[model samples]
Target: MNYMDNKISFSAYSALFNNVDNCIFTRNKVSNQVKWINKDDNDLNIKIKNEKRLKRILFNEIKSLYNNRINRYNLEGFSRINDEKIKDLEINKFFLVEDKFKGTSGQYSVFPRTFYCDKCGDLRVFSNTDEWKHFDVKNCRNKNCNGKYKQFNYVTFCPHCGQIKNIYPKCETHGTKYLKLIKNTENQKYWKVKCTKCGEFIDLYYSFCNHKDIYNLNHSISNEKSSKVMLLPVMQNSIFRSVVKTIVDVQNLEWEDNVDSIMLGSYLGKFNYLFSSNDNVNNPERILEYITTVLKTFEPHKENPQKAIDLGIIGPNLPQIVSNIENTITEIKKNYFDEEFTELTDYLILKNYFGDNKGNKKFTEYIEIHDSFKREFEKLKNILKISEITYIPDIHLISSSIGTNRGVSTLEDNYLNHFEPHWKSKDKDIFKVYSYPFETEGIIFDLNKVEVVKWLIKNKFLNGDEFNQFMDEDEAKNIIMNLDKDGEAYSHLKILLHTFSHIMIRRSSLYTGLDVDSCGELLFPKSAAFLIYSTSNINIGGFSFVFENSMIDWFQDVQLDIKDCIFDPSCLDDNGACFSCLYLPEFVCGFFNGFLDRDVFLGKTDRYCVGFWSIDIN
Candidate 1:
């Protein structure tokens, strides 16, 4: 017989050989040598040719031996034996003996299988080979009710100390304490122990009972658990609705080209399909159930049963279970499908910012105009006067504020923490920033016509000697030279745009029926553009309506408002800015309300330096 032709049959025979005697065959270093070790310390060595005939002969001999033993023993199910009975048995030393006794398959041992009759509450141990073969189909042997047997590992605890008895045997803290089985009021069996050290009764059985009661436990164990569970139902509903809304929003977004929209639509379709097919995605109850099941299996074995009960694992601790379920789902989503899901999620956020007609237009125009503007200017440009303007309506705005308590604002902080030079810098050296989440309706103001900032050294508009007194001539020159050599002009443009953005936000809020605190600014200094918008948590379209209908009035007011401040001469002289003039709400200003000086835009009152607008004369 060809080994290849009868490979499937031979594989079945090999499995049978493994299950019956817990013996495995292996090839020795020398060719044609086969070695077998049985659970009874019996070893069989056979030498044969490297042919199918010899292999079949060896297999048949092993099978015959196993069958003879089975006939003699006539074993049924699992047989209980004392430790001394298996002393000479060739058990695999590396295999966990406990796992074998639990009726789980191990590297060695056979003729012992354990199962519990769920309905009859009867535990059965089978020692027969035929019983193991038919274990799954067996029914309860108890009288009056025959229920199918469920495989379960029997757990026992020390009556004296409540520690797991079989595993620990002797507890160092409590000495040798043997567990005695006792019955509860319901006649259900349990293990109990009393600690001799303190004469305190430790109820191991009660802990197991508590673990079983998790399905019905009502009270929450912790505040965090309560909060998470309460939020789970709401989060589940919100997440599904958000996914659907995102899909619809992606569909309605006016892409510049059909191809981009089509590609995005295709991706959204996949996301929708994935969510729809997974029933658990929107089912908080199902997620909670899964968490409970996993906790029962793993947590009970590793943690104190009472602790698990307290966590609501053996009870209705909805919040704790909800958190676990949420974490599990998040991990599954991340690992599933190799990060395509995460990419789609990021794309959805991108669509939210740039999906509308106004957003699309502003984004495209900014790109086109910035590229042209960068090449035209030798140095950074500042707003001199508006030559042309277009108002994009219904642009969404998001703003956040940060303070010292909340650490640095991710949106505004620029200093690198990991940079070696800056690592030693103190918090006082930087502005204290914090961000509060805010969202609102907004507008985009498109502009054309530009004026470039002049080199600070050549500007003789005011008192040069006074300017040098404040900043060293060499430091000022270096700042200007660095702007040219390393393209620091971009930073100058950002400062100009940022300052102007604050002015517009302040002025626009005054006329646009919004408070200065409610208005926010988004700066695109690299593009030499900025947008002033609303940042109220509620989406009131008042600002967008004003920009759409009365933009000319808003623009005129902004220009007039920035010409001078109520605190000017002083505001312009001392740091060139103040709360009455330059500073808006921290949320409205992007750079933690720092790095602003009206003199950068408007020429200084004392004419110590020329502004960007003043450079037009030279």
Candidate 2:
């Protein structure tokens, strides 16, 4: 009956370490279920009202995780949740519950209360927690039997209903009251629960139920018999999969600056040729050019009649143009004054990070590393497909789990066990979604867009004319950023950058002192960049240590791993990613171990695939 202290970290609430109303596998002990109850004045609950960009995106993602019949996602404006007593409640807010716990401390109860006497083999179920705790100290409940008790290690999980409970097998003649649970050491699949009085037994591995949820879901339950219910170990790791959305603080900074810079396109009325990379619109000289031209409009007599604009004048509205340009520019510069940070502000911000202006610019958070190692980095940048390598040390990564799924890994449509704990006000109808903040070091690896377009062209996934469509780098960059996130171009770029991030994390783990599991990847697919940063909060001068000591070495050693995979053609299913090579732990990847392709870098061995290195840059 030995066990580790029942303790959990604050950060764990936002991660898989421990979740609200989920079971946790205790060391040398039966699994315990824990949950968080929302309180009005609970000081321990840190209100997560910051990181608006991350928050809105996170909310949209969580909303999408649940299969609402109406589908609240991508609905032009913010979703107005009309609560109808359907337990899902309204996802209007969030909070970070940490520190000395309030609701969940020592509140864990023994799960799968069905325990059996190893000697007598009879089942004992406990419906009362206090009585169970009192009698748990003693042995077998049978008279004159002092057999050691063993908690049933398995439970029935109703994926659709999102409920877990001990399996109760009943017989036609004699009920489950006299049931005996039996486990065969050779195979767990053969475990069974039998009626001692009738000798009739039912396999525990085969279970059933009409899976339903607290939410009034209108979706039809699966007719597929196997999917009706799942039998799994009580401590199975896949019981809960945490769904979290993260954005680097640097991305937040660039997101605001870049969005403002893009807005400059509307003011100049330069929709004909939008500026792109290098933020040409944000260039001081570029700003001056527009400013000097606009200032000329202030001249009274000098203002030419052809240029004299009025909103009422159909042909040339100089007055309206001048006012719009001035206000837009002034608003753009004021972005520097923002002090508060947020995760998500609106859903529009998720699909359109550049051109969309619905989100409030109430946050600022970054530094780019290059000048110090410009010469050394030039070579790294010269590496094939390496468009740019920005060393960002001590990055602020704000991440939070929006919800979790059971009996499945992804936030799929109609999740089986979607558990999103509501940290809402007892007095109000608001629900608080929590997030955990970590300061870590990272490196941003951006793939060359031109080369990617060329590769996509080679793969015949994109039109070849697109490469030369825009000569101005700014215009091209603008078009690229403005492209829909779910479009073909973004998907191609996302897969390439995601795969590159995985390989780099593996290589960085070997060269740097950081463990692979200690790192996390945040991908900026639109910009064709991926960041590999530390997840462990105890930052030991995180990425700088790697950047200063072993960054160059990482690039050198990457080719060695990418050259070949231990499980070659077999690993080709994922386009060349397997655990033996590019595969990474689930935590390190932000996209839930998806959108990876070694073919993006290695080129399909048997096909006409133009990988990152397929084209010649030397």
Candidate 3:
């Protein structure tokens, strides 16, 4: 056969066997022998030639057959094997079929193939197949029919009234020879029943007595049967409503599972949808009010300290839900986890000061303490470190009097400026000397000549000019001293230097301390003091001087005289001729009085310094 394999025809076999006859006898003589081409009749030669044509025809036919078989196999083979796949392909077919059916019919009724007699309550078999065998009853229940009840009949019924009025072939919906009085819940009295068929409540007291045992038809007593009615403990209004209102008022807020979050959870938009839409069956306000009433109602019950108490109207199983919400509310309130408080604290801590007042420093210290407490608060929140109260740091002002008794001040500039020109240094040692001289007569010179002469003079060993300069000042005052003998020019210079030194030391105190020891020298003792104080709280009063006992003792005497040790307002006063008001000459006496008078203070020790006036009363 000329079977097509990849579209290649196998025609070569026919070509090779075209001349080979069925009865061929061949003798091969290679060198001198004779060869017989055919041993059968010539008809066999004719058959051989025709066999090629036959084979060609058969090959074409068989190839066409195989092709057809393969085509049909794939098309129908897969279709018959898998039902689901065939159904998917047939979906379009049903749409067309349904379209045709829909045009012809509105609706139809399907009747039972077999049924019991309505009047007699006897079962009959009107089954479609012979497998449903029928047996004869001794007496037929139908009073009118003379026909024996031996076989099942397919009866016809009226379409309008649902009666089996016709019998041989069949009918739909109606037709009956005798009346069948049905005992359903709707018609009978005394037995109260809810009809599953029509969802109508009926009392079946009258006609239903005959079938009472079959339906368990008693209605007078409570059965205590399981019925899914209403969900009890319907929610009411509450603080929960306020929380939810707050959450809905805000946006994109969510809270964790805790009392705080639960309380605040509503504010975080948990039930925002309710207020936006009035579709809720229960009034929103009333719902919250009811919930609040329920909670408050339960509050007293909790104090009774009994386990597993019944919650009557709310339902027995609602205690857990109520408790959970209560706890969550409590947790949220305890944390003060509100945006307003956080914002206020942030503003307070970060506020900046304007002037050079030390009050700003105290405010800055307050901010530091605030930040530290905030950190601790956050840590406690996350770790749940429970406490009745928390310790918070206080800030106090850096006093103006800190370090007054701590370090030393110098007297060189206060006492030595007048001697500066007449003084000399030999190998870093300064010394004072007196001179009276003439320029040529070294003691007598003009004031300008005397000033230049003094510039070149040495104190330890007076050069010629130093000797002349003092001689002029001595004589200028000598005529006046001869008028008033004790008048002194040197004393005025001493006072000017003293005021100069005091100004320099006071400026240093603005940075370090006022009682600066040896301002010109490198080695000097310095004192520093710090006081701590507290700010107002929601529940507690303010505080001051917050520190340990050791720290207080190290910097100050334990016995603090509240009155004298208090900050001095007048020390900053500069009205009269006290130390602060002193000019050049008076500055000397005031500075000396400030340094020398022990009465200016109480006694102090190396271990402790009494502040301001004294430890003992005047």
Candidate 4:
């Protein structure tokens, strides 16, 4: 058995880099269309930090892809996503491959399959089979031709159905086989394809191709439909949108497993600091104190703590809430697993807690307020209207891309739906996915809850009555999170944080020497904060390094950059954003660069200074 081995980054194997299931590939110095071997190696499997939620999200994505397959194959038995437990069988064909891969194929050919011989001026189109043996030896079919064959770097793409086709010559005499490629100008866009026999040529271009003629795409159209196919360079950026989803290795604290009693106790511990002084587990009176302290923080329950408790509002488990708190609170000190807060609820509760349970450097986070240059940090945080500047020394991320979005950069739903779910072969179906692991260091800027609400209301993105009832940060966060989609405050907060994150990334890139895209942002709008960190596989000691050494410089540069865009008067005159001011690469910006406005950062360039990051804070 012959084996071919190749080395490529897991990132390169993604559809983003063009080595997808049916796309053309450039191996060594030669290029050919490719298909991965229908088998996967377990060694290639990597785990995302939050596998359960990751599985749920990926199941939806893969299921959509499998569903998109044309129905005529009678490809029934599509399994529904069972969120109860995401087992191996759920992702059977998903191959999470690493850096290197090996496989053997029955046949591989230069895509377009069209070649030109300079010596005899003959153009030859090879068949998909091995019948053309002489071409394999690096020579042309013309009897007296001594020149080597050269492949064209162009192919035709169907804008309608995403089908790729080989270029065909349009001459009557020699048809496609005896054509010659004539370069009319230095630019290939002006080049022409000619038939030597007829002395006739047409510009290398896009035209009509019958959809039914494409080999495997069967479900979309009838045999009579013809569509205009665009001629694109093989490596053009628009050919595919690599559908990779990168998520933080978020840690869920099993908050749901703890019922109402222990829940109230946790709230008491975080809000009232009850755990520090109380040691008696069975003391009945301290339990009331814990419940009362927790209730007083809520406006509706403050006037009647025992009434809410008796009415089964706070801890429905009754005696269990008190007993579980006594038992579980100390277990955290002895045998409990380490805790790392990633979710908004956990971060919201614990970040406000003074109890000292934030875990180590590896699990979830290690956050300490940015106080290196106390004065500058205070000024920057105040100007940015953020309450805390958390510096996490280590951050880990898992990212995976499936399928290919062809013909446009806009990733339409149907394109994502077309990713192959499983390789089908007579009970040999196996799930495969390619996942890449990245580790780096970064920081999170927690916005002031009060300021966020004020900004939202001022911009009319939020109603004053919405969050007014909840003064406690935790209560406000819960209410904010549970609000429906029309609650414009939730989305605008994302925009404010998203736009703020881009400014930091663009500024940090200057210091770190990484492309702005190499940095990724994760917005916890519910928490009113965003985590900006290195997305690159390599860890160059990112956000923390600058935090320790040059945070002031970092803050200063960001302010100067945003204050005056080179496209100023015009850009600020518009939405307060343009490419020159705040736009990031399409894939880099989490929102597809939507909801961004420099006005969010600079507020109004008008007489009224009403922006969140506006320098005119009174």
Candidate 5:
């Protein structure tokens, strides 16, 4: 056989071996008849009984190609044995194992069945259902075999729910006693069950029923199609090494004395009007002004309370005034503090970006900056050495904490809390879940940017005493611990970069004909790099076109966009983001819209006055 054929045979062998091993490990005795046929000799049928012996034989067979590192597959955290175990193991009527390497042009079957041609020795597998029985005779590949095939009817027990039944039942809501098995264009099998009473369609149970094997060989084969059979270790090691290097790089920078310096802190105890007013207050500004006026009148009472009280500067109605202000603010907050986007446009935008992408292509780009902010642009250019790149996007599934850890409460807590059940339940693992794919258009920022930012924080932005006051040793230690483990933390530079990325994503979406949720951002604050890109399934070609056609215009527009917000002045004075501005859909954002402050990007707001844009070059 050719080398390509040999690799395919080995992959199939590995898959089959893993499946048998899984079946045995689960103590499934019903489907014990596992067979492996030799490609060169059709008469040779190897009945696999001892899984350990089979592993040794297979390991020896592939050892020459993979060296002695074949043992890596058995290691904890890397092996199929460590994967989630299948709750139930039931043998269908029959299982047919096919030799893909030796098979004739049309001999191999998509699923396992009991049909074995007596003349050609070609085995055809089908789903052990009534619908499959009707097509079994017609599916035989050998034309001269006279449509002869054997069928086996064997009963098996379900490992999950401990049910021993001939057939899985459909939802009772559907009048049909059972679901009908159907195949899509991809040849994937699923049971179609529609509930006429409720008009509800359910696919989840069907997927669960079809993929019963703990080690799904079909899924393994499909996943391995894009990967090298022998280079799996090399790829895994490369990723591990890159992550280690990033962590080590961060640790090495710790020697810079100002590493522990606090660039920003949560507005917890600080007397900020933003946190003082509750959601019910329609106009926080007016209430804040009134409070300021009331406080100023108490200035004389600060030194001489009795004299001021006698003068009516302090009165019997003081407590009533305080209660009235507090109640109004509380009522306003209770009414208006909502995280869910009110408009259908927001939902459509989110769906466009995160919903299943039928087409397997996506394009993204960095918008150019305007000439007016040329100085800030130059600084950014210097920090991130921009370059063109081309590569497949690496998509990842990530779960994040719902609420912000900064002590400042947000409307997201109420909306996102609903997902807590799904997060905990294995069955309903859909809500608040997100898939993020990286864009090739990214830059590796200059390390000097980190040093410069650190220097600015230590020397120019904050005094030693002020820095110490904000820096919490225990909190810093906890952050470092999290960084070492998961590479996530609330570093000053990270917050700055994260905030900047949000502004860019929001602005880019508007110009690129994409929704703000369609655009996602990746921040590498440790490296001072951030990438903003499209998260849509199909290549809209809008971001790339916008960058190419109106790069300067896009950047100029972004600068204008971030300079002011619809809820501005108030948004600036408060937490620095709102539904009308930086907050993005849960799917597109990594941080869950936490640690965002536009003032950190624009430097125009009274709060967080020190910003990258405001940094003096001299």
Candidate 6:
């Protein structure tokens, strides 16, 4: 046979090297059953397993690659070896030998699995402490990956080439700090190098603290040198930066599982109230007066379309009703208050209802007598519809303070003490025309819905005899001292009746879950509104003043119509007295939420037995 034919084929050669049984069979020096090494044969084994000798060289090459010591000298040495011999050597020793090329001298294995360049071998470590700094790759530097590189210090280096790496963009908003590895040439311990574009040292845990030296490779940088980083704007507002960072992380949280929709809706409602609306424009204070006047005009015979012509009630024939309102406003100012419509329509409403007990009827019956009043209410509704607003406040917020905060004996005491002064009257004639009420505790107590109606019918001669016992001439005189000959008592009585009617209706409705049980005006405190609006669990029994305060914004200025200098005790609920019961203002502040579908908290829709009309202040 030719020598070329005797040469082994690639497969046969690999089989002989890789298969232990085949090696024993081909060599014939050992049996497959027991080819064990022995001390006796040590010197006689000079046949030098060619595979073992070649493996020694390959091991040195791998070690050099890890130390980053591969150079011209090593490459020349590798060239002297045969390819097949080297392959056989590597395969035999692969499992037993350490992969020096995959780990740094003092670090863990970088890519213990595979060390090929195409695999992009890298070393990564993580530490809550600063000990493992060098050899830590916190993030991929590759522009596209943007992957976080773990911080595994001297534990390992880039297995591919033993190169050091870094973690970058520690905080994206600040976009200033980057993490690099630092270690002494012969030292095992490592340090982190934070090179920040903003120049200030960012602490790892307390991320915004000044600690440049800890992150600086050389602590030799002077204070002035370090101060250079201070000039940056990014460095100046650290608190803002921290907040931004916190918000970013917080935004990533799972809020969907925690907060319910009702809470979200409430939060949005408050936010919108603060930022939205132009209701206060032109004359906010007067808006409530305008609305009140429009309501009072509906009191029987209070409206005189004839007066529209008599006073010329402002130049006739305006295209829109608002224009008519404007004219009436002009007439009220020109003919009444001095030609300038300064009284906002809202305030005008209150003034007209309280300022005059007109038409010789009990004030309670005034709105019922006036046909023009109905027309004005309709007009106000149309104006509100056009404006597309949620609420036309009947009351205005003039001033407010918590009773408890005033150092009073109690909240109740504070309210009573503070509002007592408004009970005093300046002119008896003005009082007589207004029929101001006695602010006395007992009288104020009787001013509620049931008692006021009794008073109204007695003055009207409707139920005169039966209610005569409750009516005292001296009390009526005290209340009527400052009044119209026909008397302002009725006007004063109407306002108290109207507003309290709402409170009464709302209170009754709140006790019972049913909505239709109550009628007339409704006072919906926030807690009641929340209960009414909720589709889930509701607990009205536990409701109290605190709950109301927490959920609703208080109505501010309110001018109450009272019958005498004595407090209209009728305004008091069973809950005891309040300063507001002593004297009522023209406009008051109250809270409103979207009430029932057809029933708005304070919007126009006279159909529901109760409605509110939006007045045009301009």
List the global CA lDDT of all models. 0.36, 0.54, 0.24, 0.55, 0.34, 0.23
- The lDDT leader among the candidates is 4
Ranking by lDDT: 4, 2, 1, 5, 3, 6
Give the Cα RMSD of candidate 6.
37.3
Q: Which ten residues in a row have the lowest lDDT in candidate 1?
A: 239-248
> Which 10 residues in a row give candidate 2 its minimum summed lDDT?
358-367
Worst 10 residues of 3 by lDDT: 238-247
RMSD of each: 32.6, 8.9, 56.0, 10.0, 24.6, 37.3
lDDT of prediction 4 = 0.55
Q: Going through the candidates in order, what is the number of backbone clashes in each?
A: 29, 28, 52, 13, 11, 85
Using TM-score as the measure, what is the rank order of every candidate, best first? Answer: 2, 4, 5, 1, 6, 3
Give the number of the best model, judged by TM-score: 2
lDDT of 6 by residue, 1-618 (tens): 111122122221111112111011222111111111112122321222222222332233323322222231122111232333223221211111124342211111111111111122222223322322332233454455544443221112121111112222243444332433333243422223343444443332221212132334353212221111111111111101000000000111112221112122222121222223854423322333443344334333334544554565432332233344434434333332110111111122222222221221222233346544445433432432211101111211111110000011122321211110000122211100000000000000112222333334433523445444455534443232222322334343433333433332233334333232211122211101101111112223222221222111111111122112133333222221233432111111111111112122122223222222222222
Q: Per-residue lDDT for 177-223 in model 4, tens only?
A: 65777865777656788777767876566577665535444543434
lDDT of 3 by residue, 1-618 (tens): 111111211111111111111111111110010110112222211122122222222223223322343243222211122222211111000001124322311111111223343344333433344422333333455667443322222222111111121122221232222223233443222223333334444321222112111123352112222222211110111000000000000111122223123322343333333244745523323334444555655665565424435435344545665676666566545644333222222122211111112222232234356564445433332221111111123221110000011012224332211001111222212211111110000000011222212221221112353233336633432221111111232222222223323333323223322123212110000000111121111212222121111111211321222112222334322111133322222111223233221111222322113312222211
Question: What would the TM-score be for candidate 5 when compared with the true structure?
Answer: 0.32
Model 2 earns a TM-score of 0.70
- How far residue 197's Cα lies from its native spot in candidate 5, in Å, is 31
Flag regions of model 5 displaced more than 4 Å.
1-490, 602-609
Q: After superposition, which runs of candidate 1 have C-alpha atoms over 4 Å from their true positions?
A: 1-383, 387-390, 394-440, 446-450, 453-488, 557-560, 566-568, 605-608, 615-618
Put down candidate 5 lDDT per residue, 355-376, tens digits, no spaces.
2122222212222333453454
